[model samples]
Target chain A: MDFSSKLLEQAVDEVSQLPGIGKRTALRLVLHLLKQPESQTVQLSEALLNLRKNIKLCENCFNISDTQLCEICANTSRNSEIVCVVEDIRDVMAIENTNQYRGLYHVLGGKISPMDGIGPSQLTIKPLIDKVQAGKVEELIFALSSTLEGDTTNFYIFKQIERLEVKTSTIARGISVGDELEYADEITLGRSITNRIPFENSLKN
Target chain B: MDFSSKLLEQAVDEVSQLPGIGKRTALRLVLHLLKQPESQTVQLSEALLNLRKNIKLCENCFNISDTQLCEICANTSRNSEIVCVVEDIRDVMAIENTNQYRGLYHVLGGKISPMDGIGPSQLTIKPLIDKVQAGKVEELIFALSSTLEGDTTNFYIFKQIERLEVKTSTIARGISVGDELEYADEITLGRSITNRIPFENSLKN
Candidate 1:
């Protein structure tokens, strides 16, 4: 049977645009929302809209924030002398939820992927270098994934920071493999970050 | 671990509120968006906001719309003589995707459920009755499910329409059960709707 209304079609079309949500999943979501009270549906819409509109990246660490500097970067109570460098904001959150790290964060935006045409210049490495050279920092923790790209990024960052006389470390590798940070549970990621080891000179096993 | 930033915590807390997303899923989604080009992440945020801000329900059918009347109601090619009654807007879209039915629709908003305190008066049933009485409709198709609530709703609607002269019928049963209309595949739902049976007055089985 044909949908007699365009209004319903439009809602489904919009919902299907989300990641991993197909036409069928979008249909289910839209139908579920329609069954809810008007107020509740409105809240969902408002929350989704707010997720994008009200939040931004902190200029200091590049983590998502509602202000200029993300709360992690802005909090004075956090360790100002040690910065935990990560590939994305989610890493910052995972680490934060564990309450293990009190230091600040610097989001690399992404790892070095030459196949994807993402090189050293494309990342936020310059800011990290600058933050290190500006002094006060005694140790920099590398919270990157254990993927090939992540290893390459770690080596590249090590080369960049070696000239500055600061120590560099990376999150332990035993808990992760490949480009799979998205699937790592919080406890595993947390343990990896807490047990970070000194960055080695080579990328080989 | 204690979060270094309260803002990051707040954002994660907000993301967890979305349907089917737990804290870990929320973190993954948030981090994925963070790694994307700023423009793409910003676009997703804007889309979410627009979904809530711009889309409103059609005053007549309560289907989501960007305008006063949904596209189906405004279309001139659709037949105004028959109106298919459904439980929600999802049913409307399901029928539409078949490209079969060429008539209008009446969304009941929900099936009757005494446990949930949803009676006929709580739904758009009154509006449907009014629309039928005022229009030139010849057939009223009940596309509701065969669940207990659906049966009660169909019986109530049948009683009300008995006074009118329109040819009323319900979609075939024995095809689905246990409030399963929402789960029916489009083909099954479409076929059942096409092979609707007349409402029998006696329990002759």
Candidate 2:
């Protein structure tokens, strides 16, 4: 597209480089910014710069942090004996929103996807094994997505620490609470049926 | 959402302030940037800052520009006597993409919408009239959307410059080139039928 100003063109190009934004949407966003007060743009730019320049990752869990340890890893009241392994910080936020888990977490960075050239070596798998070898963790919970890559990563990590004293388990797969049986996918509905718990046990939640 | 790092949270909040972005999408974008090298984020942030700080609008047409007059206004070959008035720069880009219409443009910045507290005084309508009153323009083309506000803005500007010895016309409305008649809306079909041109004239393109 022919932009009247080189500066506007450069900014639109940069914004459109993001994952889902297209050139037209980028132009709309940039034009909206132009219509706003100058201070709004300043704050936006400064926030991004400060994040890239000053952000750090937790040494123990590899989650984003402002210091050596993340907030969850640094907290004393949370259970340190159980570690829920997730693919990224987004999973951390999702699990936290549920308010169901009280244990600490370990971010694997991503699942093992050979098709994408991301292997166990590229993630924090070794660090997780080292944590398990230290013997502080009594239970390791696999909380990755239900995709094939998630299962592969889970099995790979389980094998690495299998002989260790840690008891490993995966989050359950079942029909969501509000979903109808007919709407459920075959795999999920089948698992929910085969692994159906005793009626009284299901009432605890 | 709970962000372990304050810097990351701030960046996400800033990004989510854009028109269509939400908190989760903002977090995903921020994490994507974090995974990339530092220089990429730096370039993104700097581009936004530079654009907001250095950008200027054209003096004659009120379109975005780097100099006193925009490129179109400064071009010698384009007909300055014929002007196509639009709501904003997006419309200018849309018309330019068609590769027709060799006339210059006047961007009104926005249409007259009382619900949004926008009126003729809030737009560049006066400067457009000034252009016509200068006695150089021979034809004025209205190329706004067909919404209520677009029509209102078109008529408001038309009354302001009607006394001048210039011909005025709006861009034609009709069923799109590839669309079937059955799928076309009633108002559009009615207008297209009532405003039908000679069959030979339709073949000129």
DockQ class, candidate 2? high
> What TM-score, to 2 decimals, does candidate 1 have?
0.66
B125, model 1: CA deviation in Å?
0.7
The CAPRI class of candidate 1 is incorrect
Per-candidate interface DockQ score: 0.18, 0.87
Worst ten-residue run, lDDT, model 2 chain B?
Answer: B1-10
lDDT of 1 at B146: 69
Report the lDDT tens digits of candidate 1 across residue range A72-164.
777899888888889876687678877678998888988999999999898889988888988967889988987799989988989877989
Clash tally, candidates in order: 13, 0
TM-score for each candidate, following the candidate numbering: 0.66, 0.97
Top-DockQ candidate index: 2
